[model samples]
Target: MSLTMAILMLVGMWLSVAAAMLWGVLRIVRRHSHHHRPPLVPAKPQPVRRPRRPAGVH
Candidate 1:
């Protein structure tokens, strides 16, 4: 094969590999984000507690 053709083929292979790696990274990021999403509504509120007085100290 000619030198120019060989160079082109090498560059094409490198580009394809880079594109595949980028695609895999994006997929992983998307899946991770999907699993970590926060709830849309707030959680239930807890009731307040009143302080207790010491025994025989009133």
Candidate 2:
């Protein structure tokens, strides 16, 4: 193979390897992140009420 062809092939192989490693790392990160997340169903918020005024007091 010509020098240029050999150089291109070497670079391409390295790029593919890097891409594969990156994909695996990201996959693991996503999995762990989901494991720590709260449940999908959210709890209902409690209603707040003002205390009743004393009898005859404004």
Candidate 3:
């Protein structure tokens, strides 16, 4: 095939691959953000207190 034909084919292949990737990514993003219901997150635990150390222990 001629150089021009080869270049055109290469460009078309690249564009097709890019479009497929874009479509896949968009579908995944939409599925992730659908928000049919609110997400459930575990409640935070309360911090425990530490005992004080003795003074003048140098």
lDDT of 1 by residue, 1-58 (tens): 9999999999999999999999999999998888777767758777898899999987
Q: List runs of model 1 lying over 4 Å from the truth.
A: 40-46, 49-58
- How far off is model 1, as Cα RMSD? 2.9
- Which residue pairs clash within candidate 3? none
lDDT, candidate 2, 1-58, per-residue tens: 9999999999999999999999999999988897786767758876888999999998
Give TM-scores for every candidate, taking all chains together and pairing residue i with residue i: 0.69, 0.62, 0.60
Candidate order by TM-score, decreasing, is: 1, 2, 3
Top candidate (TM-score): 1
Off by over 4 Å in 3: 36-58
Each model's backbone clash number? 0, 0, 0
* Stretches of model 2 off by over 4 angstroms after superposition: 38-58
List, residue by residue over 1-58, the lDDT tens digit for candidate 3.
9999999999999999999999999999999888777877769967889887789764
Please state the error at residue 39 of candidate 2 in Å: 8.0
lDDT of residue 26 for candidate 3: 99
> Model 2 TM-score?
0.62
What is the alpha-carbon lDDT for the whole of candidate 3? 0.91
